[model samples]
Target: MGSGKHRWKISIYRSTGKPETRNPNPPTEFICPISGLLMADPVIVSTGQTFERACVTACKTLGYNPILKDGSIPDLSIVIPNLALKSSIFNWARASMTDPPKAVELADALKLVRPAMAENGEIENGVLGELLIGRVEEDNRGSNLLEHAESELTRRQTGFDSCESLSGSFRKTPLALATRPSCYSSCSSSSELDAPAVGACEDGEEYVGKLRSSHVYEQEQGVVGLRKATRSSEDLRLSLCTPRLLSALRPLITSKYNNIQINSVAALVNLSLQKLNKVKIVRAGFVPLLIDVLRGRFPEAQEHACGALFSLALDDANKTAIGVLGALQPLVHIMIRSESERARHDAALALYHLSLVQSNRLKLVKLGSVQLFLGMVKSGQMPGRALLILCNLAACNEGRGAMLDAGAVEFFVGLLREGGFDSESTRESCVAAISALSYGGGLRFRGLAKAAGAVEVLRDVAEQTGRERARDKARRVLEILKAREEEEEEDVDWEKVLELGFPSRTLTRVGGQSCRNSSEF
Candidate 1:
């Protein structure tokens, strides 16, 4: 009886330790809003919602911009890694005495969110159907949305049929399935899908489907073809930038193969050039991936990633999101350290556009970018691009302060004094930066310019510079300096009159003799 009692206690302890018997309902914040599971790798999206990274990627792949319980659609463009939430989740799991939730694989995430299949095993003719038909619906503001999926289903049926008729080869079918068929299924095996027979697959949908294939070679072919198509055709760029295509291309940006990574990132750069696609690409969460590529080992992929960021930053809607997603530091690093000239150039341009946003300018200043770029200018490395960024920075108070603190006055004056830049634009940019600084930095700028001998340099530039804008900016700087000097002298004169207890103008010296002006006094 004693042995049996002991055995019962041991069994009870083991049962309590099992994962199934643990608390099934965790805290609400611990659960991913999209996956409805504990977030293993939580991230904060642009809309300020926390979700599992895989779930967000899967949703983007399906082009499902779901209206949340609050009736607000989440913007997926910029996903910042939520390490704090992730740490809290693990702590909660540990305290609850249960195994932490495992990461949701891309395949599992797709299965969870992809449109439901029909009872007859045929793909349901709704959301997935419209997507297969390549029908993109836009709101009055030209923003793409999935609101009209069911209403347009019938109208798009003929279009899908026509596309199907044109691509008679089963290999050319653009349909992408969420599930991996088993051995007994009639669907093509993974081995066959991975084959290297990339033919003239012109349709964007077909290439997207190939991109989702399990085989690396097929994905390479898909991205290469997609890149080529989107490069020249503006229509293809508009049509091919679906969440599905972007999600498929996302992981490939970090792929191990050089050809795959380079082509995938280049394809993204090509797609980002379209105005309609810019915000969509960002909302689909491409910015973080692009930042990762900028920090990655692949040089060619990094160049394309820089170009993609530059392209995306051109959109006003994307500017803040890009900066908020932690892009500024990497951009600055690449702009300074990247060996590829194209990468550095694009990174600098990306910084320029991003700094147009006031928040990004503050961020750039916080990241100590002002000094970094100023140093680049002094070293003759990307001086034009760096100056352009500095000009944008000077538009904000924090940036203006940082530029002055970094001794930018002397740098610009020195550059002008040296007088042999590659183009008139470089000189114009430096003059513009100086003008901005002088306008914003107030008395501090006046002191810095006076100390750096900027007054004489500006006079030379104002009289000799070929570009009208450069000459104008130089003259503006000179005017500011003259105004400041006059103001200082006026302050001194007023102080002298106040000390003497009478207006200085009241007592005038006529031929070394004092002449009193009582009426003026």
Candidate 2:
């Protein structure tokens, strides 16, 4: 018996009306000893008289000794020899032959020899036999045979010798024989490769008689082949229209498929949005579909859908289109209800974009969305998202007042004191608030500065302003308030001002008038 490290390269030479080369180099060919089929380069044999060093090693690890010999004729009576030799030959032929029909014919020929070889004692207890049995059991139990085979093979002793003679066969030890049945059970038919064999065995007729049935092999082979073919075809097909396929797959988003669909949709939408006219297609329908998907039953799906919508909403046209579909409420619902961080973030972003448009801004305010947004900021959940929404909310006149009435300044001040305003979003929100107050209707300005402690908060932010932008904004607001104070000072009643601050000035004037009257008298 050989170890797994030494692999045998078997070559089967089949007459394709051409001279075949057999050598240690390229274009190697051999005639399978059992099936007499022409095999080509890199033939791997686990049984029969042509087993290579590596194949012998592998078989030895499995507690079996495989033989090897050079011959033009194959012995078809031996089950294991014929099956292993025929497999090697067919594999070689399939690799070398460019014509599909030729390969198919070779595969068919190998199939024909399978049963005859299986009927003999040669195929029983062989690697394929153990593999087949294990596959069948696995299929029944819906387990994996390869995993089981690997574990079993690991427990066996495997080694190799130099100058190894290929004539003798290695026999399994008592322990190996004892474990064979269990190995077979472990590999029974659930393995991916077993499908084809099962399909091959579906027929009622007995295949090889005593050793094994042909119908079982045929059915297993059929199923296995079909599965492999389906996977291969799907791989090729999906690669072609991946973008469109992903976009269409959006509705199918679920916890099980959320990542796939989201990634797919994101790629497609991103690519499409880059193009000028294609953006319309996405805006017209994709936005709504994404919004609808946000209502999914799974948190993952909602998360992914919200992310996709956020990417789409980055486009101005798409944002307006989303607003037109009345997406604000549904988005808000997801933001508030869904616990997914991604969903909440995206929903907040969508709201922020919607607020940029005046009509949508008013609508959001009218819906009492400002209160909810302010509450989100106050709660300290998703502070970045909340700040973005707040910034956009401050962009509108009514929205600014609503935010003021909703106590946004106090909440924002709390955020600043709590260090929540350290982020860029919070800083941006602060800037937007300052701008809105400075230019917003005077009542809003007075109300905000005079309200509980807004001016102090503003002064704090102003003190912390190291950046030119922040300092400039703070300077502008301060200048506007100072100018308003000066204007109010000029309009004050002089008489009332004197009475309050200088009653003596009025008394002096009255004394001077009385002195002049006395002089006249």
Candidate 3:
């Protein structure tokens, strides 16, 4: 299916061909408790539970110590490779791989997805969606003894001819991004993160659905759709968005299948564009689940999860749940990893919205967000959201103190002068952050601000910028700079100055449309 044909992509399918050969039963001794499938390489953990080596290793890396029904985990570390189990599994696979399929198994699985094609040549999306979920569950339960669903899936993935034919019936991959040139132009660059963070499908309904259909949103997850859609209309109709749909879609968001999980998250993100859906999703217990995905290291999933959380965070009630779940560190990790610039941008935007709450603000400070923000903003990578995030964090004293300690004051001052005040919002944010740092920071803060040329930058802005808010914020920081300049005239304690905020290592190299002239102190 093309990007726009989302609604009627699936319903009935042609039996096309007989289902692949499968054995309906396998030796029980081959299964691993963790994966519920024949173990490729089993290992016994310190707790005496035998699991697929990959599963146990993943749990170990993620710190997931499983608790059985008795609520006990004997030990997590002492893992030993089970050579005996491996030999048995290899023998089982050798036998099972060539087994003939039971006629019932072939008929039943195909019947689930191949009901009847509609007159319009469309299929019911629900049909294929359900079939995919069934396949995943059956694989988890080891229900199909022959041609295990996962092995079948692997065959489809590796066999080019099979995959090509499957693609014709399924939108089996992410929609090609080339079709959405307008939506992607800015997102392809870091500039969009600096701008308003909205505009992709910022307006239409069909386009919104189409974007939500993209499974590999490694790019900004089309977040612009949610931000714009939510802002354009506030008269929400709860009936238009059903609780059942939310209930059915939530589990898909957490599915182990990345394609299914991404599409599900994007669908919810589309619904969240409505003001009411934001509260409803949070009420449906989605916030915690979404944050859990962020904590797990799924690159593509993280991009979508952060975007959904960013939209949901627009509501005040959801902010507490997100923050209380300790979402800060994971968000910071995204910024540091650069897995996808889209994930980084969305994560920053999520933090920006979450920072509206004071408690979240404190958590952000303690989590070393200031350092991350400084790194991003200083480099002008994802600068728009970075500056905006910094602006929000600058609202509180702890955030401001973190910024100073991270040596962000000088950077903000230089930013205030860059591009000759072309971006009003970024300029305003820079001024505001400077003002926050200057206030209650005593002489040291002011000295750092002045040394960064805050007085000169703010003066230039006050005279040249037309935006009253920018003019006002700049003028206030300027006043502080002038007052502090007079106070620290000759007794410039270099140590005191050095202690507050870091001096720009490249003060002479003004970045992103340089307008820098001279140092302040």
Candidate 4:
């Protein structure tokens, strides 16, 4: 390590690429049921199952309650710090001349837990668990217990120097720590986490394999190459999106290294651009990872995450799944709070497409997106995009009611009257939304439109706008406004006929045949 500050980075090596040579006979009690890795910060859930804290957080984040090997489902509602277990694991590491296990990062832990969770929380022989164990054996080349213990001692004595030399050969670490763990001090120096030169290989599979490498530099190179390859070639994107590759790329999307996280997400965005890959990516379970990046601290990564999600949302097949995966709240949050204009733009478009799904429309309405989008439009911040989403939202009953209640008719009619919109498309979106709200809008719709002076503005749109769609929508809304206005202007009050107490059949005869006075009846 470079200094006392960099000492923690050494701890990350134990969990990343190849399996570290651990004490072959370490106590089973020291291992986390969720991660199978030695526990650094163990805690007892209400179910009395002990797990690494990061693992528990991952389960909670995924809304997965894992069934341990003993077939016990951990009640994650209450977690108590297992100080004694933590101390024991620490003591074991020191006694074995191995570094104490570092807490797994939440992002990495999520990857570990996901495979097991997918198999109904069966941790033993789970897909990822097996892949991890296999990689450990393959990477270590069956190094004997004596050699492993010697290597740990040697690594500690040489400090940063050995870390640099062994950087490419280091074994992968399993599981991660907290959301933003301090384990990796970020070996940003060229001499430390140096990436192999790009263009050494053009094979996308090779790049995917590099992603699985325990070497930080190698993983960065792999993701960067994959990003470039996918960006330029459509064929490569389709070919590169295999399940194995996606599983490997998942963890890096949340890598602590800025280079890895940014490029990994950008690569995923490129991969998601392919039409066929959309559903595969979603079914493979990457939505939550992208969401993590969207809510993560890295701005560039967040931008790419939004782009990936928007690309996925372009497919009609993925809309409901994306919405069900808990994407709405974060996408809405990004629309409002992201400083990056690109992130906000993509997030808004994604929401617009997602709202095309009926359930997502209701979810958006419940999320208070109507008011949020209206406010954004009012503030002239991404007005076009926000309005487009609002247009989609208005297509549903819940969304229509929410928009009506939010004064959408007045707001949109005002926009049209003032001719404040910058583009015809934006104006068209407003008109389309108004048209949606007007359908099945009985008296209240008539009242709102009349008050907003919608008939005059819509008449202008129908007569003046060159875009045929806007013209058609305007004409439709104008029809609604005029029809309702005519109904309101009618002089007859049907209530008086009922109050007169005429015989019902006689009244029907009077209306259907010739009108007759009550005296004739």
Model 1 lowest lDDT segment of ten: 152-161
lDDT of 3 at 278: 68
Q: Evaluate model 4: give its TM-score.
A: 0.58
Q: Score candidate 2 by TM-score against the native.
A: 0.45
Provide the overall lDDT of each model, using Cα atoms, as 2-decimal numbers: 0.68, 0.45, 0.54, 0.69
Instruction: Give the clash count for each candidate.
Output: 4, 59, 8, 16
Colliding pairs, model 1: 61-244, 76-283, 77-282, 77-283
Ranking by lDDT: 4, 1, 3, 2
Kindly list the per-residue Cα lDDT of model 2 for residues 1-521, writing each as its tens digit: 36433333232234334564442221233543333434332233312234222332223223232222331111111123345544555555456553211222434444544554444333423343333423435234212312322222222111111102211111211122222111122222223422223322222122113112134344333323322222223222223223343333333333133333333333333233221323444643566666666765545446545655554554444556667777788888887777765466556655655565556777788888878876776676655556556655665678778877777666665555556453543564555455454453265575566564655665666778454444445555565666677777788777797666633322235447522322223
Those runs of model 3 whose alpha carbons end farther than 4 Å from true positions after fitting are 1-237, 240-245, 295-300, 416-424, 482-521
How well does candidate 3 score on lDDT at residue 243? 63
What lDDT tens digits, residue by residue, belong to model 3 across residues 1-521?
A: 57546534422221344454566466666665544566666777643567666655444332233433332332334568888877776776665554321112323323322331232233332232223322323123212211221121111111111222111211112111111101111122232233234343323443334334545342234333343333223332233345654564555567675554554565465566444466788888887778778776556667767767776775555777788877777877876676676677567657765776667888888877788778876776655556666665765778877888777887777766666533444555566566556654367787687678777777888788365655665676666566656666766777878677555443334455534343543
What's the residue-level lDDT of 359 in candidate 4?
83
lDDT-better candidate, 1 vs 3: 1
Error of 4 at 370 (Å): 0.3
Q: What ranges in model 1 sit over 4 Å off? A: 1-202, 491-521
- Backbone clash total for model 3 is 8
